[model samples]
Target: MMRLSRKAWNNVVIISMLLMIFFFNGLHKKLNTQPVEEGVQALLPEQSFILAMAFPELKIERIGTSWRSQSQQETTWQGNEQQLEQLVELWQHQKLTIANLPVSKISQTSADYVASVWLAGEQLPAVYQLYNIDQQYYLLDKRLQRVFELEQADAAKLFPLYPF
Candidate 1:
């Protein structure tokens, strides 16, 4: 058997501990992050940055790092900067699932509110139809032919301009 001095043993233990820390750190990061699942996509594609979002009653646009929000019903700015920025952040990170509800689940009575987003590099703005049915919220992307279901809180965050 190889014999080691006390000093050598201490150094070896520290080296092994460091290797373990590094290994576990890498492993933790890999485990903590969720794997991308099929049929799940970001609300806004990361490649394109959003320049503005115009809902039925309000419009918010990026003015450098800050944002400008104004009422569509009127020309006055209604919401504060912090709220507008949070709305932008939510749109940037929120993920949407491809809705699989049956046709019968959603009736025809739900009134649709339109939300338009102007993205960077796209000449035409992307438009989404928002709906609230039985307190559940949905955003439909007509171009993609997909409906994304959202929770009530998230729906409120997306369309705070409205009374909903």
Candidate 2:
């Protein structure tokens, strides 16, 4: 039997312990790190001057904390400023990722809608397409890359209809 010397065994144990510590440290970091969307800057909710959503049947807009909707309804629907602000904040801080599928190839359905966020002085708005495919809602950037997964209920809140 080729038995290792006591000193040799001690060295092996120390090396094993060091490797285990490193592995755990790496795992801890991986678990704790926030999932941030790469290649995109965080959108500032506070700096947003206008928000709009366009659908095949109607259009909704929020300007300076006031909400208006143009549809077949006789009265324009108004929204709560506090709720709208919170929604903006939620979108600003939500974690997103680069889509695995290309935006051009994303299958669109009849329920899809286009949303835009405009900064204080920007001539063009940052556009996103919200799609409901197979019951899951996805938010795709203007370039057609899927950026965020959203709940259907939350998406509905963006275009609430006021009961006449």
Candidate 3:
């Protein structure tokens, strides 16, 4: 059997111990690093809304429109019954089935005319709502998925379907 001398063995043991010490020291330095707040500040932001509004370049797609009652005492945005029926019929002709048609569901403050109908081949069906309190028409933005209160002035500019 080939044997290592005592001095050679000692040298080998010393080299292994030094390597072990070096690895442990490196591990200790990593564990003892200062608090992570410095590294994290760049990742997390302090403000979100200001960032959205200030950067007008960031396009915000309209999700829907809100209608307000012409008169404060009116309580609801009233539309001609016949006109509403025709609107529904027009949508039906386009192959969209509306649920809860011609029904008024009253809320605490206002009444909502809601129709669940699908648009084209989209999996998420769009909601058609006529709010009685505001007595106006709103188009829910399918992309943003939120209803916007429609302004009579901005109505024409927002949706081409109904020009006011």
Candidate 4:
């Protein structure tokens, strides 16, 4: 029988382990990765302005050219009409990256918040659910069942009053 030195035996064991790893790696099934859709897609439909936004904490309504917020605690928001208008505009025209499937298919779990927005000319308000998965923000439209992945800054822009 041919005998090998201690160093040679160690090298052989290491090489064998490396070969096994490479073999298993090659045989492993690859994850089906969907290409990210890149674009500035509008968060809300065009020409749609929120006439009213109802959250668990507060309800904001459009009064004439301005807006007002009344809290559930029977308190009112201190922000003026300009701030309300800016909030409306952010909802109206904010662009976000639409979260693609299988994330959309998988992330239909419980939401942190569910809010309703009454848009102009719409009798029924559109419902939206906000979710946080792995520290990333996602907004799901209950009506359309579409999920839009939001950036950290965009989430802040959309919900300035709400605590996350």
Model 1 gets an lDDT of: 0.77
Please write out the lDDT profile of model 2 over residues 23-118, one tens digit for every residue. Answer: 999999999986754654443434455566444445556765565555544534444556555555555555444445555556544436665665
Which stretch of 10 consecutive residues in model 3 shows the poorest summed lDDT?
A: 48-57
Off by over 4 Å in 4: 1-39, 74-77, 102-108
Tell me the lDDT of candidate 3. Answer: 0.37
Cα lDDT, all candidates: 0.77, 0.58, 0.37, 0.76
Write one digit per residue (lDDT tens) for candidate 1, span 1-164: 87999999999999999999999999999999866555778887776788998977788899998999777686333678987888888888888876775434544545467788898988888877777776777887755556788877877777676566
When 1 and 2 are scored with lDDT, the better candidate is 1
Top candidate on lDDT is 1
> On a 0 to 100 scale, what is the lDDT of residue 42 in model 2?
43
lDDT of 4 by residue, 89-108 (tens): 77888787778644455355
Output the better candidate (3/4) by TM-score: 4
- How much is 160 displaced in model 1, in angstroms? 0.6
Query: Residue by residue across 24-103, what tens digits does model 3's lDDT show?
Result: 99999999874533211211112211110001111111123321112223223233445434433343332211222223
Stretch of 10 with least lDDT, candidate 1: 102-111
Residue 122 of candidate 3: its Cα lDDT? 52
